[model samples]
Target chain A: MKPSSLLAPVLALAPASAMAGSISIDLPRLPVAEYHRPYVAIWIEGAGIQPRTVAVWYDADHRGDPGTKWLSDLRGWWRVAGRNIGTPPSGISGATRAPGHHTIPLPADLKPGAYTLKVEAARETGGRELVSVPFTLPRTGGKGAGNGAGGEIGAVAVTLP
Target chain B: MANFIMFKSLALLVGASALALPMTASAHRQWLLPVATTYSGEDPWASVDAAVSNDLFFPDHFPIQLAQIKVTAPDGTAGAIEHGITARHRSTFDVHLTQPGTWKIGTEGFNVMGSFKVDGVEKRVGRRPGPPPGAMGPGGAPAGTPGGAPGRAPVESVALDAIPANAADLKLTEAISRNEIFVTRGAPTTALFKPSGKGLEFDPLTHPDDLVANEPGKFRFLIDGQPAKGLKLTVIPGGKRYRDAEGGYDVTTDANGVATVKWTGAGMYWMTISATDNKPTTPRATERRMTYTATVEVMAP
Candidate 1:
């Protein structure tokens, strides 16, 4: 089945209020010798303040060694907040996703200020990439998008209402 | 002959060859390069290599003495060095990072080296067979002799009061050297970054383990617990064997004793700084030489 079809149901289940402020992430499929789902982290950060994690997707369950063992591979996120948040962070962690568009709801309690949304992805035996989009709180008129350098990630779009 | 003697004493004081001095470009640089500066998982082990070589990160000249190395955990407690081995060119060791946060691995050395004259005969202060046990004057017990490495020739100098009362031309030089690197098992911490307020030290505005390429990293230098002004800092990236040119830069401290560098690329970097001053905490010493060296890995942005 097409990966985009898998997102229809997830989008339908999202609360109407969450649709007001949400981020859409696209994981690009690449032609390579070996394939593995990329572990990803999404977070919001502002000037002079600690970053807030939005979502983290990885192989939460493995037989012997858990996927958290390689979270540091996502250097950009690990250095900022992942290391402190601990494994399977309540309410923010999920299983790894297949190649396609994935939408995540933003926190409603975010204060009114200028902030940046960062999406970082890392894969085994593959390259890492980060995509960033700057947005202001309290609902801006249009949508913002950032394109990754094109390795493990594709395009990330943010919609603020 | 006097120049050669001075060179040997400087080598003994710093635990490397005379070429290891920071001032000379042709000099051999000393460093402790880790396999990786950051790690994750339930149990992670960090392996490090210690050497003095002409090229950065390539162990070729001589292995740093394992005895001089020390490890400090994030809680300011002593860490252990395991499975240590010294090869022809480099010394290797393993550190099992059982605790979370940052760990420090390196060495600190202090020695007094100079010459004095008794009965018109010039006698060196630091060398094999120091003054007799009786020569240790009241309250002069050869304090701070750099780790007392076993089986190695003792380089401890005689105490100030141990010098003959009739001794003339009493000249002494105090030397302090520090070399270190930081590794983080999970999250980076500053518990191991506290300055000892003695000799040359680091007051990092940016955590050493959190450095990133293309971003400015600010670090302050301190001498005797105070800001060090006009100090020269040299940073050289590793992998010199692959590049035709030496990719490194030099920066000087401002009045605030802070040196800022925006790394050009991502890799391990060797940093070094040296200073000379007449201020000596030990009595009768005419001058002091201080040197600090560190190896840090910069992540790609």
Candidate 2:
């Protein structure tokens, strides 16, 4: 049998330090009229497997309208994971973030493999942008950063321990 | 060579449209343009505008009759439209997308038109007062007198048996058309895309709601649930009124009835496919004409 299959169960029981990682995303403040907090989605996409979502910042709760209405504006994430998982995906969906840098914790128990961290952000009456950082799992200490075109997203960095 | 092929296919499209609406001077294409294709949140609603116009998506001609539209929800249950109003240029309605999957809003029409000879004079049998239901009328109210409305004549559709048996030169043509658009509330589902095994239908390889700009969207065309080979599909992006050129392209289906369309940009696209054949389900009709049109939105990647 493959080594990954044998290590999968042990890694599931491992402590957070062994498998935990974090993704820092920067939302650029744009000089545009009628600005709304952008809906952001971060996920990991690997070959030959379903995309695993790490965090989704959206308007989960709003007065008079469900903030989730614009989740599809995150086009890349919607095509991969948003459309499959229903609105306000448990444990992953949260309130929209302001225009600044924020850190999101990665999900534990990700199998050892090559994956791409995708960060997509879309603003109402504005623009949408996606940034991706490719990296390999089970690393000692490494980091990768991707920069967007500055319409919605800014810099995205993924660090693994 | 590519330009020549495109011109030929466009000519064929115009010819098919002329055959479909024989009375119209200009070819009028029908479509259902949704306010948005994808939506979310609780109690989400989708509003759609229905029209048939000379220019794609421009409500310049007339409105589609609201009586013919049918909404099919994700669970295969019947959904009804709210506040259906037919104006002079376009008809509008709202759908409450209560279910969290893909919903189909469309209309299907079937009619027979032909001529017969009586006393050496040829008389048409299927010419109604105005255009057929679900088609563009001559800049007025919706056609077909289903409800008891004044100043409108009832649609005159003669049955095959109603025609005099002794009449000579009996020729009948069957016209079948479908116009559709897809909207998803939260998650996109395929339950509504299942073919009914009749008429011109779509058996999509790529989900209709998942199309992206500059990406190839694969779709299969079926006539009576069989592959419609060598068919021509014309795709025109919306907002033709603002552009200097029409900016449309034509693609032909392969032997498997599949056509891959790489959308040029981000926006809603109006696609149309029309074909004619000798095969007709109606017993007396000798030729069958089929037209399928869809309004799909392509998002930017």
Model 2 chain B is weakest, by summed lDDT over 10 consecutive residues, at: B6-15
Q: Largest TM-score belongs to which candidate?
A: 2
How does model 2 fare in lDDT? 0.76
Native-vs-model 1 lDDT?
A: 0.77
- Per residue, candidate 1 scores C-alpha lDDT tens digits across B1-301 of 5433332333353363331244665677778999989987677889999987789988876678788899999898999999999776788999999899999999887767677777877666753332322343343333224323334344334655678788799888777788999999887889776888887889898989899997988999998788998998999999989989887789999998999987988989999888888987888898888888899999998
Point to the candidate with the largest DockQ: 2
| Pairs in clash, predicted candidate 1 | none
Measured by lDDT, the strongest candidate is 1
Per-prediction DockQ comes to: 0.47, 0.49
Estimated TM-score per prediction?
A: 0.81, 0.82
Q: What is the TM-score of chain B alone in each candidate?
A: 0.82, 0.82
Candidate 1 displacement at residue A80 in angstroms: 1.9
Off by over 4 Å in 2: A1-20, A31-35, A140-143, A146-149, B1-26, B128-159
